[model samples]
Target: MGSGPTAVEIISHLNSSWQKVRGYQTETEVAEYRNGKLQITKSFLYSFRKPRDFRIDMHHPHRGTSLICCDAEGKILVRPGGIGAVFKKRLSPDNRLLADPSGQRIDQTDLGLLIRNIGHSLTDQRRGDMKVTDEGGRLVVESVASDHFLPGVLTRYRFVIEKGTWLPAQVVELTPEGVLKRVVTFGTVNLLSDFPPGFFISDREDRGGGGR
Candidate 1:
């Protein structure tokens, strides 16, 4: 399918949809180039709420650690998995410990920011043309960026947006030379008006410790 929508048009629709979301939870899978081969590097259960409440529960690699950021404190409360769960640390948003291998901060991983970045790339004339096409029954927005729109890489981008919700279901980043760089998939998205009480409050915070 071709001649779907202009980049500007798609971004507008996505922003409208995103503004209606009060909260959401999703299972996320991140894959990236490692040792010159694309490998699934991390999997996590992510939860987010409006006004800056979010959580990340690592399921692979770390396997036990969880991070929670609540608007109350504006700091990341880390509860390590395994035996380390007994201890917790409250770190600044830019703390290296809160960063991924690609140096993406936890606070920057929200869907709103992702769409905004894509809008920036598409609106910049130097990034070349932006195209929206129907791929596998989804609207995929494709564009190329001359500069590193993402934190660490410059690449071509394909954002597969769920037609029903206008939210990104998957994002594929490729090297300018057309090699796969990274792909992040969002699955089982559940939208809610609000989480139950104490959802964003970690055990440490609940106990009044608030980490160190």
Candidate 2:
């Protein structure tokens, strides 16, 4: 029998799919952790559009909702009770709001970027830090980052890409000490050819708790 697709091959397919996608929306369950124990889990509705535009609606049952939107113009963060604020900045991978706990500026939850990183890990194998394995019926690609690159924290990111969709089912972030930092599980994904007008715009300007 022949070996199935390599990590690099799967990522190539994923990257090709991303190039043609105009936009996508998905429901995600985000879990934050510390010291290897489970912390809390939150649900979010995430949407992304081409040419740098994204929105996140974090659900808080009693407290309401938190909305974060980024586009070519700037970022808008809205608090639960209708208070929101806007900042002027173009949407890019370097945006501070998109920075992860390790100070790496990336859309940590993006499937496209996650797939691309798998390719990067394979390309630059100097550290021997990447591995591909089969786990829980998904293809798992794990990449480890050294402290030299990230300054302080030595981190590992794991991507579990589903076979059928070629999209990530879950993403895990672990610290140097093997502490589980965060895990995000993706739910239903909807690829959209057209979105509503001003869907990325926010009108709330509340300054409570630095919404974003």
Candidate 3:
């Protein structure tokens, strides 16, 4: 209830924490809704390194499927699940096959992009109507905007940040009428200075069951 960190201050904290991260691995769960109904939920073991290296191991729905991109400009390598795991395919970054249920591309799902988007939304606002509160033991930052803060979506963003790490534990997006649009929850984050050799290499020879 007392005065908490402002939106700018929270953004600064997120930026500072992100700057120290050379790479990271985390479990991410995304729930998307439509017309006030929960449509789908997807889970993944998400891994990322600086300068656009990423690997996504789908844990729910598409179980054994894995997607990896070692270079920013190169195509995404996809290893499908089930019997399709025996084969591998490469597709462009904008390929529909590489998009999530919500149409978000794999290249756009990193924490760095999330933080940058939040900063952009806040900066575009003429009036700062952000509020920071103590929810349970976590810090909740909520902000509303007259126009759509994120692309064509006009929703209120609620960011629940973890205590010690200063990283987001969960992010909730709600429509102007208070309908839940999406919820992204981040599991325990493991920050690393570097990943082992060939960690992001998807074409490496392997038994290819699920993820590494």
Give the per-residue lDDT of model 2 (tens digit) for 88-122: 23334555655655454434446666556556544
Using Cα atoms with residue i matched to residue i, what is each candidate's TM-score against the true structure? 0.88, 0.72, 0.86
The predicted structure with the larger TM-score, 1 or 2, is 1
Candidate 2, number of clashes: 4
lDDT of candidate 1 over 1-88, digit per residue (tens)? 2487877688899899999999999999999886448776789999999868899999997898888898465888887898987677
In terms of TM-score, how similar is model 3 to the real structure? 0.86
User: Which residue segments of model 3 deviate by more than 4 Å?
Assistant: 101-103, 126-128, 146-150, 204-212
Per-residue CA lDDT of candidate 3, range 50-132, in tens? 87898989999789898888744566778889998777777777776655555567688788887776775555752347777
How does residue 81 of candidate 2 score in lDDT? 41
Best by lDDT: 1
The candidate maximizing TM-score is: 1
Q: What lDDT does candidate 3 reach at residue 110?
A: 83
In order, the Cα lDDT scores of the candidates are: 0.78, 0.62, 0.76
